[model samples]
Target: MKPSIITTLIIILFGLFTVQVNHRHLSRLRLIEVSLNKTAAGLGISRNSPTSMPKASYSSRSRQRHADPEVDIRQLANNLIEMVKMIPESESPKDRGELMNSLATLSEFSPSQIKSLLSEIHKSDGIDDELRKSVMGIVLILASDQNPRAGLDLVISSHDPNGSLMWEDAIINNALRSFANSDPAGALKWIEDNREVHPEVGQKENLEIALLGIAREQPGTAIQWLKNIDPSDRDDLAAKIAKNALSNEQRMAILEEINSSFVTSLDTTEMGKLKESVMAGLGASLDPDDFEGSTAWLENSDFSPEEISTITSGLALKNPCANTGEWISWMVSHLPDEALPNQVTKSFSTWTNNDYKTAGEWLESATDNAAKVPAISAYVSQIVFVKPQTAEKWALQLPEGPIRNSALKRIASVMESIYPGSEDAFKQRHGL
Candidate 1:
């Protein structure tokens, strides 16, 4: 088992040399394999070894060579430019059409990016009709985005007089909607600048919608626009929208317009509806002061008694006691006694029956304002029909005048009716 020391030493050196050689060989092999792999990958090889590097490289290179980088960019840019160029400056319909077609295919890019590209194109001059339409198409698509206002602004700013009327209508409508939910003042400014284009673009509806939106924020401005709208196109929808946009002053102005247009024309039905609307508006505001001018307007109209009654009812609802009193005073002072007897009687009946105590108090407080005397007398006479004793007490307090005499006669008549022998006796005692 114990061989010679030299033999053992030789064997150990050989073993050490063999181990070193093996380590160096393994290191070299790893280096070579790594180099081979890298070269293969650089040559486009699949590591799985199913395909050769050259073949894979050729296919990938071919695809890169064939790819179109600007296809999407051109399409988007063309679309935006086309829309902006709709302004007569762009002359080529064919180019615009092509751009439009290209834009229709651009669904991969972000709308904002597309909008940016379009904006760039819009600023460049000499873009033909074809490019303009393309640009417009892109703008149209973007008009549906959450921030379509940008597109709307571009459309409006373009001032494309020669553009398709249909496209103009769409732009105006989208702008109106955006304005309604956001910037009302901006929308009004747009309407003001483009008023002449409205009929040409069939944008009346758009204007109406926009005005309605602006009304909540700037009723005065909105109502002004509404007045300028053509009557030929007026409808319930327009009326409803206009009704909401008006301020007190603007509403009176609109009533003036309606009076000049329809009332003077003797359009009774239209005048009635207009009066009803104005009164309803006043009722909602509950401002008797606002109705003073309106009352005068109504007085000048050939309104039926029923229509006047309706207006008075509205006034009562607006400011119950206050408006009723003001309106009664106005009617008594301005209207001829004979001309409004029935109306006075009805109003008196309403006041006295609803609040006899208040009516009696107001009667006693009234000064020589003789117009109110007949009305007061009528009310007293009517009251005597129900409460003879109360009416008789009130009659005795009235000052000497037609009112007092009328109250006395009313009391005597009622007393005789209730107690058959009282009328003549009472008349004798009262020296009637």
Candidate 2:
């Protein structure tokens, strides 16, 4: 009786243990399947088959999952080396050239890989023009990357005594365009140093572009270059070169000199063209007040329709709201009847309503009686339309008189229009 009971208990315990082990095994297998599905989705590969799992060594799998920087760098370097070696020495110039270009594309990797390939090309004496251009392309890419100085050094060292004309052109143009904006002085220096070896390297046009870039960073040096050009030549190209070299103040001085010296004797038509050129040059630099003054001067001066148009165009470049109320008044008074006060009011109303604070500041600074009326009206309209709460603040700032009364009336009118029978409600709400 005791043996039978013990055997039954043993069988029951073994069955329970097997059930628990099977459950644990099934849970672990499900987790693995979920992880594999996630990895497949991330890689944009189908997970419908068991073959979706990449076959690789354990170490390779670990490296792929958590990249080892040193191993990645070594593999990248090896790939670049293999690409370079594929360029056959005895192959057609075109084929060898294409392979070199492929090598240059590898410059997106480490600079060290680029340097190694370039050094090998330098050592090999028989490379053709196409291959040379590809090398320079790589150098340009490297110059645009972190180790620009190293790229520059490689370019300087690669000067061929018997290099083809196409090779020289390609190298110079690529290097100039890439490094010119990055470090203009360094670029100009390199060109200057190589001008003797490559006699036609730095032409007037090339030098001008380089100087313009340098002027953006160092104006004094650019001014010195301008001073070196002959006066007759300078007169011919002064507007073009000075357009790049001079600061805003210097440009104004140049315009004044041109006007005093040449504007008086010229015919109306020619003088008009010249004024247009000068105005365009000062388009971004002239202050809004200065534009108003210039416009006044043009109306008084013997400027033709063309000259007037030029001055007006320059004025238009400035934000209309930046013009003082006095200036706007003058414009309304002086402009043709077609450009009426209502038109100005409409434009200013739109601008003020758009929360253009600059325009608002200009409207506030306006002191002219004719200009102030429309400007204040437009501002009041803005408050009614977009910012009712701000209207009271504006009204309170007006001096006690017609202006204050007019503004208050406009605010009341707007409130009545928006909240009928609620003027008192608005007044109380705003503490008017």
Best by TM-score: 2
The list of candidate 1 runs beyond 4 A from truth reads: 1-135, 143-149, 156-168, 197-202, 218-220, 234-238, 242-432
Q: Give the C-alpha lDDT of model 2.
A: 0.49
| Model 1 Cα shift for residue 353 (angstroms) | 37
lDDT of 1: 0.51
lDDT of 2 at 243: 49
Once fitted onto the true fold, the runs of candidate 2 whose alpha carbons sit more than 4 angstroms away are 1-119, 123-129, 147-153, 161-186, 217-220, 227-247, 253-280, 283-432
Please provide, for model 2 over 306-359, each residue's C-alpha lDDT reduced to its tens digit, 9 standing for 90 to 100.
444444444444455444444555566554544444545654665575555766
Error of 2 at 117 (Å): 4.6
Q: Each candidate's TM vs. the true structure?
A: 0.33, 0.37
Global lDDT of each candidate: 0.51, 0.49
Q: Give one digit per residue, the lDDT tens place, for model 1 in 1-432.
A: 332222221222122222222232223223223433443455454345331111110122122232244555555465444443442433443433443333323333344555555556656666655445534543443343324455555555554556652234544565466655677667656666756664443356666666667667655455445455665544343355434633545545545555555556437776566556654443343345654665665667665555555445544443235345556676655555454555555656677777777776777766656446555666677688778877777676667876687689879988998999999998887778
